[model samples]
Target: MATHASAEKRNRQRIKRTARNRAAKSELRTTLKKARNSVKTSAQDASTATVTAQSQLDRAASRGVIPKERASRLKARLAKSLHKATAKLAAAS
Candidate 1:
């Protein structure tokens, strides 16, 4: 229990921030998963999903929910995988 009023206020802020961050992280995971799955399924649809995921990542990073470098890394990897997958499909045709 917080003995001081300031401490109690800080605790409340922490609780709210935690909840918001958790929701952002959860949504981020879901977006990433959808991007990965789309990459495995179809290149056309995968591009759209990847873009959406990248946008979400940037938003999260900007909000401080995730690090900027980490978000950039993830976006790069997603783009790389998408390119490789599309290339493989192109070669197959």
Candidate 2:
């Protein structure tokens, strides 16, 4: 429990920020999962999902819910997977 007035206010802010960050992180995870799964399917779907995931990652990073470097790494990985999926599809057809 926070005893001083300033401490209580800080605790309140911490609680609010934690909840907001948690929700953003959860959404980011869900988006990433969708993007990864889509990459296993067709190229068109994978590309769209990857774009969406990248957008979400950028938004999370800008809001400080996630680190910028982590977001960049994830975006790169998503792009790489998308490229691989497209290449495999092209070879098959």
Candidate 3:
């Protein structure tokens, strides 16, 4: 229970920010999952999904929802996995 006016306002802002961050994080997870699934399904679909997931990660980082380095690392890992999957498919054909 915040007694001071400023504290109350800060509390309110915190609540709003918390909800927003939670939603963004949830969306991020969904995008990541979609990208991973697409990688296992098709190369074309995986490329599109990876791009979408990378964009989401960038946006989340810029918005302060996730750290920049973490976003970069995730993008790199996604790209690497996609590349390996595509290469394996190509080699098979």
lDDT of 3 by residue, 16-87 (tens): 999999999999999999999999889878999999999999999999999999999999999999999999
Give each model a TM-score.
0.98, 0.97, 0.97
Q: For model 2, how does the per-residue alpha-carbon lDDT over 1-93 read when each residue is reduced to its tens digit?
A: 899999999999999999999999999999999999989866889888999999999999999999999999999999998999999998989
TM-score of 2: 0.97
How much is the lDDT of residue 4 in candidate 2? 100
Worst 10 residues of 2 by lDDT: 40-49
| lDDT for 16 (candidate 2) | 96
lDDT, model 1, position 55: 98
As for model 2, its CA RMSD to the true structure in angstroms is 0.7
Candidate 3 error regions (>4 Å) = none
User: Model 1 Cα RMSD, Å?
Assistant: 0.6
Q: Give me the overall lDDT of model 2.
A: 0.94
Instruction: Give, for candidate 3, the lowest lDDT window spanning 10 residues.
Output: 36-45
Writing each residue's lDDT as its tens digit, candidate 1 over 1-93 gives 999999999999999999999999999999999999999999989999999999999999999999999999999999999999999999999
Q: lDDT of each model, Cα atoms only? A: 0.98, 0.94, 0.98
